[model samples]
Target: MYRTPALLAPLALALAASAFAAGEHDHAHEHQPLHGGVVVEVKDVDYELVARPAAVQLHLRDHGKPADVSQASARLTLLTGTDKQEAVLRPAGGKLEAAGSFRLAPGTKAVVVVTRPGKPAATARFTLK
Candidate 1:
């Protein structure tokens, strides 16, 4: 029932440090994309998918920084009602882009799979609005 200050100080510091680490991990998936798009976390990486009338772009970020996905390839599948379409995305600048007219309405469902030469594939699913 008797504890010294030296013993309590280290215990308090350890608890505070653990709480801070938990907070950081909880906020890792709550990132807002620089470009207006939907962000999904795949294998601890953030992938922001932007659907436009003329193109579909996928942006990669690792720990809140831009990730080089130039050597990566991606496949996008879009489903609207009973219709489905798929496209191959090629690297363009800082993102992977596929140039085609896509029908991304409020209820469209999308699934994207990205693969690199020596890395396992990662998938992200989204519903458009």
Candidate 2:
């Protein structure tokens, strides 16, 4: 009886350890953001502002698939000289584009938030002058 109990003790400990590991792994996956259907290429993103035209243009290229940008929507909040401006983005020519009517001066910061129809939302940071 002593030998049997000792053998079972190790098996019980192993089972407990395995259960704890699996639970931790499951929790990690649960908290991860699921990037919807769009695969964003962060390195290819560019932002340009035309102060005279009072417009800001966002350029994004998706080499993955044509449908990636089609269903994506974007919103931008620009911080310019202590003032904030918001712009709505629309799908245009394989990219999600946003144009602001307010003239963006140099040293402006912009935060772009994009949401895809079925995928996880993503954000991009840019500067405008």
Candidate 3:
């Protein structure tokens, strides 16, 4: 009985250590964006924003799979130096898009707020070039 308890102690400690280490593993390894865009995590969902001069695009992903945004709406705020602009985004082909002239130079800051029916709004912030 004494030997069995002693053997189980080390096994329990090893299992605990492994569980701790697994929890400590970096989350970045799982959030890489397929599109060349800046990504932010909010409420276990990944929002990838692609800014351009002609339009701004936002992609949604959940657990590395494309998420449906057909019933969602978004608002984008862009800040560059002292100039600021806001646009309302609508769902377009599995992504959210706003068509407008935007100043998306390097160091520009963007804040995106997305809303869906019966769900709380989700927000993400990004700096883009």
TM-score for each prediction? Answer: 0.76, 0.52, 0.77
Runs in model 1 deviating more than 4 A are 1-30
- Which has the higher TM-score value, candidate number 1 or candidate number 2? 1
lDDT of every model, 2 decimals? 0.87, 0.57, 0.89
lDDT (10s digit) by residue, model 2, range 7-29: 99999999999989885532211
Model 1 poorest 10 in a row by lDDT: 23-32
TM-score of 1: 0.76
lDDT of 2: 0.57
- By lDDT, the best candidate is 3
Overall local distance difference test of candidate 3: 0.89
Q: When superposed on Cα atoms, how far off is each prediction in RMSD? A: 5.7, 10.6, 5.9
For residues 1-129, could you state the per-residue lDDT of candidate 3 as single tens digits? 358988999999999999999867355536776778899888778999988899889999876678889999999999999999999999999999999899878999999999988879998999885
lDDT of model 2 at residue 3?
Answer: 91
- Cα lDDT for residue 3, candidate 3: 86
Report the Cα lDDT for candidate 1.
0.87
| TM-score (C-alpha, index-matched) for candidate 2 | 0.52
